[model samples]
Target: MGGFFGAALKRDCVEDVFFGTDYHSHLGTRRGGMAFYSPENGFQRGIHSIENSPFRTKFEKELAGMSGNIGIGCISDTDPQPILLRSKLGRIAVCNIGIINNAEELCNEFYDSRLASFETMTSSKVNSSAIIGALIAQKDSFAEGIRYAQERVEGTMSLLILTEDGIIAARDKFGRLPIVIGESEDGYCVSFESFAFQKLGYKTRRELLPAEIVRITADKIEVLGEGNPDALRICTFLWTYYGYPNSVYEGVTVETMRTRNGEIMAEYDIQNGTLPDVDYVCGVPDSGVPHAIGYANRSGIPFARPFIKYTPTWPRSFMPQSQEMRNKVAKMKLIPVHELIEGKKLLFVDDSIVRGTQMRETVEFLYENGAKEVHMRSACPPIMFGCKYLNFSRSTSELDLIARRIIHEYEGEEGVKYIREYSDSKTERGKRLRDEICRRLKLTSLEFQFLDGTVKAVGLPECKLCTYCWSGKQD
Candidate 1:
């Protein structure tokens, strides 16, 4: 859960690099960084903490100062990226998107071989810089270096290297993360998410094929080597959880799909006669806000933000593992506006209901603030399955909540029958089950983000996305 954007431009690319990377601020809050190469400057790197500050504010001073033709930048969730490294290969700057699961083993291997010592950050992992540097040191060529890094890592990684000669963009072999190329009058841009491209007046050149590596210079963008195209595995969770609405992956637009999801939820509300007489419809926060906008537009209601996010504190989307800490953090991060909620029957849309503990507390706080009634709508169905691919980072278990407990009671056994109801949101039994679950959550009403609606919301053909978290399907 971090994102990066890099570019090799025909003209000075400092503005594109800074703003493109800033577009990914929603992805990570720990650190923001940028590095660039110029014949005179060699490699320049800048890092800032966005925890108490925003990327724009923190990097304002560096924007004009860090000018170059080729550069790389990152919004890092775990550690600062765009790490400038001096190795036998060359002086290079590295940035990554996606996680490396085998950091410990690789770190130890580097240490045992007396190759390098990694710098530890607040997160306690071997610096991603050191890991990428180790890979660079192991190979003779940039392509080989990336291939070595992709082949050895367990999880996903889409990376960019700004070397003394040129820039290299590489995606993980599985392509569990996304990387795309953009072309402008200036030069070429490489990024993990496409949202950055549109704002910069750049058009997508092409998506970097899975396990593909390409090196770019002022003259041309060249494919270095192919990792493995047939290993066409992409993470399924991007649609449901982490990705932004404007970003595109696998030829699908996130905003269109989420809007479709909103339309479907509106229809379902009408069919069930659960539509409430609400003054305004609002989303829980950011993720839920898009769908709420669609819902309000379709349902002909005002879309309001009853609770303003306390961004100063609760800015990060996913937190480190700790329930007590997360709960406290969540509470401190949101402030309810009594003026909006008081005497109003509010319909609130959210991305998903995980454990529902945080949500329950949130709703109760709304009521205490004088909300006449609070109706709940979820963009996606209940998460009966814990994500196997993602760190999830929020809740550890699928069964640690009301949905799983109710399913257990209904089946009296955790077997095929119980699992089937949880997946089928349209089944009469499924409807009854969700109704009961909603009653328990103390929501006046609740509607799951349907599987079809979710697919449409993601704007992807059925074959591209991994719906395993919702349907219990495994690839």
Candidate 2:
């Protein structure tokens, strides 16, 4: 849901940190922050709200006055971060990328023990970065403190800590997110997205293992603690939606995985004789394009762009807080091509259908534009649970998901027992769910990628992947 970039260089690294952090603008829309440490100026930090503007536009002026060889920056979807703190471990700036599910409990524990007190934000919520800082300061050393925090946190926590010596980069305990290191002649850099540093003349050095902690200096890196390589359960949504197309994680490129996933979906449709007779195969745009391309290639259907995204003025559709505003923005970004949609039988592939509101509107828009029959395909299995580890969805309750809502309506509270069956398209419950969704969305037909198919598309061991959102299985 968020991303971070850090740099330790022999020379001034302000520009590197600025552009590097800007590359992660797609990760978060709420906040952007940067903190740099210099011998003369100590730590110069700046945090800005990016809800109304882009990260680059908000931080451009501050970059001119900031200069440091060691620095860290982040794009946060929640609380403002790169929080500067003074602790027993000395002054350090911290930024984290994961949610703390048990934050209230931890805060209560801190209050009960008289260990720490938190400052409330405008929304009356505690700043997670401050809590993380307090947690890190509990132990005698930074390394021990980080480990303690990781062990105590219930959910994911991958972080970057900037100290006077250098920067400390730690991947989450379960490796739900990615933290990669890159090398260059001037120094080394760390980033959540691999492509961020590659543009700055840095080659792939290595990725931090799950729970691994490493310190980065200008010319060297020291391993503070090793990670449990066997305990990886990286979130599968990265390749499906969150990750940049050019980025590679665990040696798998996002675009490559998406294309393969589409191919697999197409192959399945063909084998089952479910391939529809359509004039064109189209994607929802942006993230959905690659999947549609693969499907078109595998099925020998021409890939067409029925609607183009106009991004020059509008931000991401999901960036807004209000559902109504988001829907409006989503509609404004898509400019329909009448030539492609008029009297055409089109099949549309989307990354995934969450609440299905936008998708329903999209199908209706196609029909209004003279689409003859609109068939829909989901690139992944139905999302059965709202993600607990990442801020991928804005839905706060399980009922916010269309699949969960449908299940509830069918079997009331007892449908939970048949979740696995419902995920299988061959099962009666799954078939009913699909038909219900199709009727509601006014689609001619709908099909979702099988769970096993998605796993195969990622090309990772099933044990090493997190399929909690689809399967509701956490191991």
Candidate 3:
């Protein structure tokens, strides 16, 4: 839900950090921040709300004044960070990406009742990044503090700490997220997305192992600590949806994997004789387009864009303060072509259907434009469970998901026991589930990619990928 970039370069690195952090705008839309340390300026830090504007526009004015050879920046969906803190380790700036589900538990155990206190947000909840900083300061050294913080935080934690001399980068304990290093002629860099650095003339160095902690300076990267490599469980959803088209994680490119996923879906549909006879194969805008392209390529169907999203002025559809405003913005962004929809049978491939509200509205819009038929395909399997390892906002509660809501409608609370069966397309429950969704959304047809197919599309062993949102497997 958030991403970070850090630079320890030979020259004043503010410009590189600015552009590098801007590249991660696709990963988050809430807050943007940067922290730098110069002997002349000390730690120059800036944080701003980017809810209504792009990260670049919000930070452009300050970029010219802030100068430092060592700096870090972040695009976050949660609390403002690269927050400055003073502790036993000295004055430092800290920023983190990932959730801390057990913040209260950790505070109760370690935080001194009378002496220790936290800065709270409007909701009175301590900012997760600040909590992480507090936890890290509790230890004697950066390496030990990072290890302690990773162990104590129940959810996920991948962070960057800005020091006067260098930056400390730590990957998630289970490698659920990513921390990659890049090499340039001047120095080195660290980023969540590899492409962020590649564009800035930084060559791929190496990705940090699970729980790997390293100190990155202008000349070299020093390894501080590392956990077991076999504990890798990278989030598989990145390839299907959240990750940028150009981003690569664990040797797999997001766009390529998505295309492969679509091809696999088409292959299975043809074998089952479920491939719809449509005039064109289309995709929901943005992330869904690649999957649709692959489907079209494999099914021998022509790919067409029936509608285009107008994004020059509009922010992300989900950026609005309220759900009603967000839904309206989503529809407002689409400029439909009547010729593509009128009297045509169209099949659409969407990255994945989580809540189903937008997809339902999309189907209705097509029919209103005189679509003869509309069939839908989800590139990934049904999300049977909400994610637990990160600060993911797509589905907060189990009931927030449409699939879970439907299961409850039919079988009540006991439906929880058969979640696996409901996700299985060949099962009776799964068939009923699809039929019900179609009836509600008024779709001519609907099919979700199977679990095995998703894994195959990623080209990674199932054990290495985290399909927790679909399979609900903790390990």
Candidate 4:
């Protein structure tokens, strides 16, 4: 997953575009790019790797030569973008924030038809944004081309394009990702996160519906096409884990929803007589704090920080490319508080236990520091399948997930038929799954927020949300 921002302003929009794109740094870590268009300079673009440094630090040097009234920028985990392309639609700077699963097939089709050829990157793959441009060029106008490109792409795609006239913004077809407009004194800006613009002294204009397309100028936002709200399937992970605390999507704030989710989980535990006796209720840092706070408030357990993540050296969302390094760095970031962990019965609420690598390390570290018992609460249900839409889980295979691994061990290929049962604690199979995970992780107890409970916490009709990672169902 990634994010982008664009500004068409009365004055030079360099600063606005720079900070707005930088505000989305949490979305990706691979590459950062920006493209600007001015009457004098025409179009100027820059792309740099952000694996070692942050978005702001890496892009700040380019600010001297970059200036424009209209610009588009993005933070991407895959290919470099805000790519400068000249086509029938004109020279437009484009960048995308979603996955395109069928790239190879589409590229092969393009090659076979002899319509056009594609340029591959260092990874020996075509840039997704470039492929989008090719698809859009197949039609006559930008609106029709946009609709066409979206229909062809197998996965999610939300994009920002910088043209001489202004900027064109389009949300993904199924609305798996969100795009919002913000109004300021100078002009309007577009972003995936509402907070990104609000912090830039811009007022909330409106959020684009699923598959909507719009063109933004300094004064007005013209709707190029309307979106279908009936087919809405916005990603649920945005609320539970990926989204920033201040971020809001589908009219619900992330922090508010997380707090509410924890409250709902506590209510369920209380009703089921499963609320554990713990000396302290602790959150697994960062995203988990709000959930833990809500759990603590509802269950009347004293909330404490038994261990803190040393984020100064390693940013909360900063990820290394390799899994081996990720596990090593994750362990190095924890700084335990002996006063809080010594002889304490700790119950930790985490955003989600995907691979359970970090959680296992954390629980083991606590026991080493003298904790009597370590219980765990996952804010979301066990992920049954790799995310097909947003690629949020980053799992190359289902075996990469701890839940899937357990299912494979017990039932082999037969486990695929009972994913729902394995996800539910009420089922005997689900109970067995929990016991096995607890034993492996060296935990005293374990529980996950049920699928229905999570939807209830989100306060959205089930038909409108995407729970593919957990339920293996699409809207």
Task: Report the Cα lDDT for residue 122, model 3.
Answer: 89
Off by over 4 Å in 1: 63-67, 86-88, 108-117, 122-124, 227-241, 271-280, 297-340, 385-420, 426-440
**Could you list the CA RMSD of all candidates, in the order they appear?**
3.7, 0.7, 1.1, 0.9
Q: Which ten residues in a row have the lowest lDDT in candidate 4?
A: 310-319
List the candidate 4 regions with Cα displacement exceeding 4 Å: none
TM-score of each: 0.84, 0.99, 0.98, 0.99
- Per-residue lDDT tens digits of candidate 3, residues 113-213? 55367877887788887788877887899999999999989989999999989999999988999889999999999999999999899999999988999
lDDT per model, in order? 0.77, 0.93, 0.91, 0.90
lDDT (10s digit) by residue, model 1, range 61-159: 877777779998899876778887878887788878666778888998888999888778766767776797787789988877878887787766778
How does residue 462 of candidate 3 score in lDDT? 95
TM-score result, candidate 4: 0.99
Q: List the residue pairs that clash in candidate 1.
A: 257-457, 258-457
**Backbone clash tally (model 4):** 0
Worst 10 residues of 2 by lDDT: 312-321
Candidate 3 residue runs with Cα over 4 Å from true position: 110-115
TM-score of model 2 relative to the true fold? 0.99
Candidate 1 vs candidate 2, lDDT winner: 2
**What's the best-to-worst order under lDDT?**
2, 3, 4, 1
lDDT by residue (185-220, candidate 2, tens digit) is 999999999999988999999999999999999989
Q: Comparing 2 and 4 by lDDT, which wins?
A: 2
Q: What is the Cα-based lDDT of residue 418 in candidate 1?
A: 66
